[model samples]
Target: MTAEDLSTGHTAIGSDPALDSKIKNYYTPARIIGTDYTYKHKIVWKNAIGFLILHLLALWGLFIFFTGGVGIKTALWAFFILFISSEGITIGAHRLYSHKSFTATPLLRGILLTLQTIAGQNSMYIWCRDHRLHHRYSDTDADPHNAKRGFFFSHIGWLMSKKHPYVIELGKRIDMSDLEADWMVMFQKKYYYPLYALFALFIPVWVPVQYFGESFKNSLLVCYFFRYLFQVNGTWLVNSAAHLFGTRPYDQNLQPVESWFVSWLSFGEGWHNYHHTFPWDYKAAELSMHFNVSAIIIRWLEKIGLAYNLKTASTEMVAKRIIRTGDGTHYALGNDDAKARVTAIGPLHPFNPSYTTKYEAPGANLNDQGLPLFHEMDVINVNNKNIKRNFTKA
Candidate 1:
């Protein structure tokens, strides 16, 4: 069906009662009462088998390459497969579609959608729907990959088990009109399985053998098996490690954490804490910090006019909201500085009811010397006097 046809068929910008009922019914605590006792051994076994086979094939492929069975050309092909698949998940699936952090041209979007299909994840629609739910209800029971559900559940257990009611019923709750309007996304949603079979499995095997002189078995092993395994687990880490460990710079209460190590592995997505707090920020990490390769690519696309509306957070605003927990007290970094400066002026806490919170003077954009000013108080004078007193005592 054409994109126009699909758009016309679905109801636009309206609530779905069925979805609401399902969410309300499933999200209730009573539904989870007996879930703890359910048999999960089969799910565990299946994941174990899948994981084991993937590693076994990857290790075997590496062993063959080192043993003079596979040449450098084959190794290069393997690397290509891994790179493209990782980009598909990070740039295409997560950033562009799930978050709408930026807009790509139709041609670029189509190319990205095709690449993402090869990763063997669900269609863009399914992935985006679940991911939106994840963001909306992060760390709560309604979140599809809630970290509170334990490490394994967030990582892979959710996929192995029966489809959660939320998956089947919450379709209407998500505002995916933009995605639905895209022809490429709609096509991929309907025909993703066939595309996976052809491009991911058969084409990888046939094309390399026919054109590049690679054996069918080697192509399957290196391109299909090894690439597939790497992409799946790498994407999974965003759910498991991104939440379980790392620094919560933006919001301490949120489950997502910022880890430079995880960011490197997951293509700049490891800045989970900042992402959770500022979901629309395109660059997950700060510019002064370690560069996020994915953000670099997106910026490049923007420069070339292929991408637009790249969302970003101001450095000052980001710094202000960053939470610092030390000495058994939590404070907004921006507010803390302001409070400290105000305290120096008078012996009153900013939050104290008796304190006059109002300032009579008009805010100055700069000091007398015309130096650029900030929200923080002028502490140079106070620091100089304290230094003089200490020097005199010494």
Candidate 2:
């Protein structure tokens, strides 16, 4: 299971692991916020200044809304954008693209690409790469925004700072061939900057001014800045508040927790405890899709033949997983009746689980090789062409 993770198909593989150690020591380690992980956090003045300006503009947008500067239609438009933009990331980048929880047709992929382009997050390829890295090296120095670095760092601070060298080093090792193989993914990656400017900034601002007779200033401030700010923060909440707060019903050893508030805010990604437990589940959460807007939208797509091959962690697996590793916060924590309905599933190999396929989750039992659970992430059958674009990156 110590088989090394493949590269992004961008960088050459380094023979010496010492290169990671070399980068680690060269930088002055910062404060301990992410448990044991610490790294130099050099501020990027431009990103910091840009964010500050955006925050100020968003506040002005809010102030103007109260003073009749913007029409109700403009405000509603922003809200609508929020929903679709968030959907692109949750269902498109995270689930469909990153996890391979479901398959979407080329038409559906184009729609998701457009929506995600509006979101102004990085291209789907990069987004999935970082997401995979986050799962592969959760809570470690290699994690892009290690929650151990505290709420602010995990939330927004990581955006305004240079990536920790370890992040760059480990990031190169994350395989991205699957994403590269997708024509839609690479197309977006190639034109991401232009698409971001056109959809995320220009169009959002221009539409209100052109159609609604909203002032150019109001449209720019509210439709572009505030709407962007809101969606970005909502996404960050899943990274920050979801981890810092909530109960870890699935696995106490992990930092991610189940935060209902986060789910509501992030467009249905708040079920951190269950999500970290079973990343392959298309639902993300173990519970019903009462508030999961992303799950609901994905289901709607499935109905229309836009998405299929949806994967899930069955009730049996979830029930048994809770009994084996839960931190006693699960609803069925002490419900022996529920636990008795599902038998425990032992690991079949040091690598694969008898109950799960393709992707291995966070709480799977450690192997005889004494490798961490993350190592099993790369233990999948790489030769499977059917899942060439599987979200389980190297």
Candidate 3:
């Protein structure tokens, strides 16, 4: 992932003077064009075929188990593949690469990149580009997968349509400078398809067939295709079901919500609201909350000197931005407040009124005004001999 490799087909970082001049430009948004505008029907057909075959094989696997042709060991292996692939997307691609929530060593990066490839999504460059756009324009038309566009649109329709201008020029806007600097990322990007073919498909099939006496076809069907399909859709569910359903634990400003069930399925990534609100935080689950398995894995790598700079939202910071509503009053400071209070004055200032304080109602509770408030403080009047003179001056 040399700088040149990442910069190819994309704008060079901080190189375009015209683009830099318009950093604050709001009237004319940047546009990407040139690629084919419409999705090929064949690709859709192939995707459908892949999904259908996966389901068919899963049902067949159940039948085989019932007839004693497949044992619990085989079923567990298939399940493991599904879990790893899903985690690879959620933890590796989404959190680590796209969000830069943490850092990983070359070896850890290789493992994650390989697992992500097996998930059969787009390459890291493409995925990261679309995801950055999604965060930048969430719930807007510009968002690649805005649930506001409808469940189907966000779930998969965006992939099928060529209506988005940015979709065509995806590589242009995304800055993959850090990733590009690493040789492993470049290697993965260059050989992703072959790696997927060898490791995800061939290896999974060959290993089981050789060691467990399982048929190659059976292993490919159950362990590879079936697992891939399940993992892909489970990841997509975060874009679709997570946004459409569930409660908003953090920012109601955005549509994406938090779902415990989705978190369970997506390895703590179902906490989408929290994620959107705090993109740099490694643990979307927050403290004492459900442990984020992805964060745990990153931590393990760091513990063994394979990862570094594991970013996380502080407890006070997360708490401040976490929405809690009661009695028609919405609480929770926005990200701006959280950042200012935490980063500027330090985390402890939230409890120190001299440094930080929220607006308080004099007699009645205030309604939600998109801000956080603390208890009212009483004011003291100082006695003065010249009170009449001061009143006359006023």
Tell me which of candidates 1 and 3 scores higher on lDDT: 1
Q: Write the per-residue lDDT of candidate 2 for residues 68-152, one digit (tens) a residue.
A: 8888899899888888998999999998887777788999999999999998888888888888877766765667777778788
**Model 3, position 235: C-alpha lDDT score:** 79
For residues 1-394, what per-residue lDDT tens digits would candidate 1 score against the true structure?
Answer: 3456344454334547785565456544442211222433235567667767777997776666667665677667766767777777788988888876667898779878877887778888888878876775565444566566667888887766554454345435667887789878899888888888986788666766877787778777777776677668778888987876544546655556655556776778877767766665567555524637888888788789888767665655566566342111123343543333332134454223122212221121211112111112221221123211111000
My TM-score estimates for the predictions, one after another, are: 0.69, 0.78, 0.68
lDDT of each: 0.62, 0.72, 0.59
Which scores greater on TM-score, model 2 or model 3?
2
Q: RMSD of candidate 1 to the true fold?
A: 17.2
Ranking by TM-score: 2, 1, 3
Q: What's the lDDT for residue 266 in model 3?
A: 76
- Which of the numbered candidates is closest to the native, going by highest TM-score? 2
| lDDT (Cα, tens digit) per residue for candidate 3, span 1-394 | 2456344434455566785454435334444222232533223555556556666886775556567664567778778777787777877888788876666767877788888887778677667767775665555444677566667777776665554644344325455676678777778788878887886888777777888888876777677766676677677778887776644546555566655556766777877766766666667655424636776776677779887766665555556566442111122344444333221134343122122123221121111111111111111111111211111000
Ranking by lDDT: 2, 1, 3
Models, CA RMSD each: 17.2, 10.9, 16.1
Write down the TM-score for model 3.
0.68
